[model samples]
Target: MDHLGSWRFLKVFLPAVFALHHFCHAETAPYYSFVQEATSAPLVSYYDYIIVGGGTAGCPLAATLSESANVLILERGGSPYLDPINKTDKENFFLPLLDPSPHSYAQAFVSEDGVYNHQARVLGGASVFNAGFYSHAETDFIKEAGLDGSLVNDSYLWVEKKVAFKSPVLQWQSAVRDGLLEAGVLPFNGFTYGHINGTKIGASIFDMDGHRHSAADLLEYADPMKIKIYLHATVPKIMLITEIGSRPRAEGVIFEDALGVRHTAFLTKDSESEIILSAGTIGSTQLLMLSGIGPAHQLEALGIQVVMNQPMVGQGMADNPLNGLFIPSPLPVEVSLVSLVGITQFGSYIEAGSGLNLAPSLVQWISKSLVTILNQTEAKVNSSSLLGARLKVGIIIEKVNGPISTGHLELQSTNPNDMPKVMFNYFQAPEDLRKCVQGMETLINVVNSKAFSKFRYPTISTQDLLNLVATLPLNLRPRHLNTATSLEQYCLDTVMTIWHYHGGCHVGKVVDQDFRVLGVDDLRVIDSSTFNFSPGTNPQATVMMLGRYMGIKIQQDRHS
Candidate 1:
């Protein structure tokens, strides 16, 4: 077998051995009670805390809360630990991105503008589905968000010990790193998680053996007897009671099991007992709207009684925009995900990843779809022809620290099963588009640098690509522009989301600094939805930090 084939075979074969080793020497493991078909069991009336969403934030938060208080976690999907295909097979890690099954670990969704994306439905949340790139937020982000600086610094360790690891920088990643420095993305900070303004090697969730440790692993901190997790418990709405002329208070949640049986879980009378919605940006916002806590007009139009007239519940959504340059190389690079990142002076982040040869049919479909979406052309050549003697390494340029061109989400219907209409007005701001162009320019420079010249094969240059894009017919341009006005037009056509969706239910608008929903008692949102702005990097580490930070806060409040 060739190098790539040998690597793929080893990845597939080694995991089964690891799985067996893990299963055989199991000691007296903690009794982490879980209800697969929650409907079959008698529903508990109340708990000290009901965390709706056993995901990145929810998993850690529930585990932490269970240390002192009775905690119940409702997950919309199954445990990743139980799935060998998703959890063990590293070669097929990205397969879930294409999975369309309702029970798939990654749930696929399409935006109003035809962009496809997926969100995690399993225990680790997106941490279980993403490419495992991990980085902390910039210090400015911490100050801007008004987070406790010291606590935030210390919080990372709590999560890092459980899942984070320094990625092994390989040949391709090293070349990319050197190229970034050569391109003037200076101050090469060595391996670290701090999000600084320069090139640096960040951590990842994937271990040395290519196995992923998710937020689910943090359940080791949980007092098993105090925590109960229910898989396939789809929460339809947060049950609330609004007294006449008084503020609404969250009572419990009404959910359904995989078997379609309904159940309700409420909070204890201890007033301190709260309902924390860590159901992610879309899920939490949709739940808020479905529970009649969104815009008054939207709720009344849907014939749902208004619980609160919070206009910001689903407003101000922001997703980091990304564009890329594919560089085909004659040599096979080590297979890896985001490791070396270039943080440019112009507020852009550049990163690269190596690829493996997938099945021909799958490759054909993907290539054809990408060609159609990106170039708006017919697939005249067979997919096999596209793959020449050399493989391609993707150089991704992201507008991380850019103008926040926020969008909004609207309810499609009163049905909880329906996905909210997401319109992430990416690059809506001229400054945002300008930043993206700068990012692409930096990436182009990096690829042209001497560090990459040895391995890089001759291909289209940046100027040639731009000029060709400029020559495209006006109507054929993105958003029906009359002309290719500038490189921004090309950006509009090529820019896509990097899956780092944030805002919507933002601080100072939908929720308070403590993450509690305004005008509502005994309720809180503790996910990316609470972020006032994107952290300008892969958000998993920050999300995990937020989980730890909030867990400590909640514990302190309960004790006080």
Candidate 2:
């Protein structure tokens, strides 16, 4: 019992006990493995399709294209298995992947304002942590972007079939859907999809055991297969290998893995594949600019070699300015905030192997869209003939006039560790501010409905919050909350970006209608970054649909 004897005994016993406890905890925890990337010579190979950034779009595109020939998805983010962020379940996964310490990509694209941004370095890209809402582009919105209405129709069919897009049938409370319908907010329309036209269209989400699903779910084509998903992979530039021809072809791409190791791949004659850039609006456009396929003046100023003088890159970038109305309800909202309210139902879809929870109720409040068109005004101008043309079935409203975003992404330094300088000039246009004011008014109207009022367990009086915003000083504008009393206050406080940047590389900029970069022959930009207009809804479903549609189209083009 002496001091020395007791201390020696305690040390020995404590060490043994601590070791046992550690082992026990490790064994009890759910076990998953992380694939260590190759540190030696690159594990490079040739394939018919090399889709960079295996994310929201590239993942599905790779899976769909793989059915035809070998497809190599080149992602800068290393393997998804190694990423802890990727292991997240449907709920509470929004804990960002911005920290570079554990995640794959070095520097995330965060706005200086912090209010408007997204974390995009992981395997599933933004889809991994995004609120699962599947919406189609409004027909009119699509048409304004210069695509025919048929494209949207075809895309909707293809996406629903491939991804098994469904709703919450068994687990969800039916009142959630019923309440919205009874509110008169959801006007019935024959077509269901975007907020513009599909008034009766339902929202979509993955059936993650009554949880939620992601691109990871649909991208997994084979079980227990090492499909080579790279995370933290950053494609800095698209390598344009000039083949002896009239025009230079985009032969391959240059990318760096999470380890900061750079590598290049050449498009071979045998596997004369396509290089798809689904790296997102910011990522894809940055890559194109770095590759010298963007605005000639911008490229020249930056001292970048001009491969193609496409002034449209980063030109028509647009995103929806989201404004939410949080009203207290008398009842606890039974609906899961984790999954979107899928309400749309088609005949025989349930019997045709699609689940009953196959539609979402989110699309119920959208306007009816009849004709969707995309007339690229920048590179190819449309005269008075295209203007003032009205279509059948639905009316189109310009909630946000398609003002080209003034945002741009450029390298901070040669070091990949240094995050890119991202500037989103939100509310740069007076029309955008006007749109935000109008959108907020709409949100207030919808959330203030009697049906929505009853969803809260304890009724919340939003008048005080609204009054507070109205009275707050200009310097005291809220960073966390975006509530405002008057239109001026709302415009001043809630004037932030949706973190959904698109159309930077519209038809004239980096890529054309087929999503192909003009100067680069084989390279295509498939991510939302290539959108000509922000598809008047959540951009994920549209991005995924485009991936699937483009994958099939490219495969067919090759075969033909």
Candidate 3:
């Protein structure tokens, strides 16, 4: 095809290519009984698989397990389906993440390290609130986790067929893609769901119309008769039956409803029945400690009965450190989530999002967040000032490749609903800071690339524009700093999260290769909590895959 023909083809059909691959995949979500309120739940219940947290991993795991076993999902938050702020439209993408009300889809929290972050409180978990970029786990991560190679691919297909959509490379993303290639990120892999070291367009959880398809949608694979999902049901502790000479067995769980009434849900007497914690990184780790499976000292101090003396339950917590540069588009840039990602060999990944017409919801969030993003003493130019202003902007961002710097989690309160006191010592390790600098350098190179020339004004020089954005940082260093020290400082002062935090219930430390808790029986952790690092560019793909992969493995193990 000629260059014009190729361009026409790509713009029209690239997004549909991967989207249409799921046809061979059978069935939609069965009309499973969705219990919105926990009050209606019977005081007692039994299932072959008692999965906790109906978020990204839980939903897929439950669906897959229900193929043969009865499953029960106890979710802390209610459904996001009827939520006004959690709409599927592209513009509503940031709204679910920004709303801070107690009942909002996103739950607001500040780390003990003083970083502000949000966790998904809605049923679909982070997948509902995330930027929706989808990609596979790194080969190294898969092998290290002892995942079966072929099974991993199959699991990815199963999840992608249901949730992932092929995203088209629009104007801003196309520019970013070319800029990455110009900067020598070689062997441009055009579009893939697999993790590769190159500039590529990955699948998105958002569809052709930019409507999101979260992990909650993966429930379609469930056997309607075999799955019972309880929304607004908070699992506080894993109910255990201890014997003096035998390992503690997780027999059931104690949970609370929205009305504060507590109930017990049990696993069957079947020897292979299990309690799976897919409550995400924070939720799983915190729940483990709350259930008396953490360090003996911490539990003793908190006045909790100890189930197992496991010291690594909440250790090695980390979040991918992120920083960005805001560039003004010469023309109005269409709003887009991540469509292009530049996976560099250096320990960083570059990606971008663009929008000119932002909704009013962004003003409050921007006012608070930009204060820290700009590293200012206060909001010099709050979002309040831009109430009706029509400004065009594109943001270029990079995540420092990691499980680099690590921290630990300790309980703040015994209440299961309270946020845990965890610290992700961002850039604390010298290597992490070095990677951050390398990423920032790569970002600068992209901005100055000839492919990005159209976004800048003809009058202003590239160096001048960078100096202006660089001035957003405090400490008034040289206006145009080319030194590594300035870049390192910028990373330190403005470090935020891509929300790809992992660890806590790390495999090999807290759990065995099969995801079973090291010191307990009939209990396993099957979420991002089991990861040593966040997988690939985004973790949702790997997380959902893990759920399905493990469900199949567990079924196989039961048969064997």
Model 1 Cα RMSD, 1 decimal:
6.9
Q: Estimate each model's TM-score.
A: 0.88, 0.70, 0.87
lDDT of 2: 0.52
Report the lDDT tens digits of candidate 2 across residue range 516-542. Answer: 777667778888886656664566887
User: Better model by lDDT, 1 or 3?
Assistant: 3
Query: Whole-model Cα lDDT per candidate?
Result: 0.76, 0.52, 0.80
- Return the top candidate by lDDT: 3
Return the lDDT, model 1, position 402: 45
How does residue 243 of candidate 2 score in lDDT? Answer: 53
Ranking by lDDT: 3, 1, 2
- Each model's total of backbone clashes: 0, 51, 1
Clashing pairs in 1: none
Residue-by-residue lDDT tens digits, candidate 3, 256-350 = 88898888898998999999998889999999999999998999898989988899989999999888777655566777889979999987899
- Per-residue lDDT value at 427 in model 1: 77
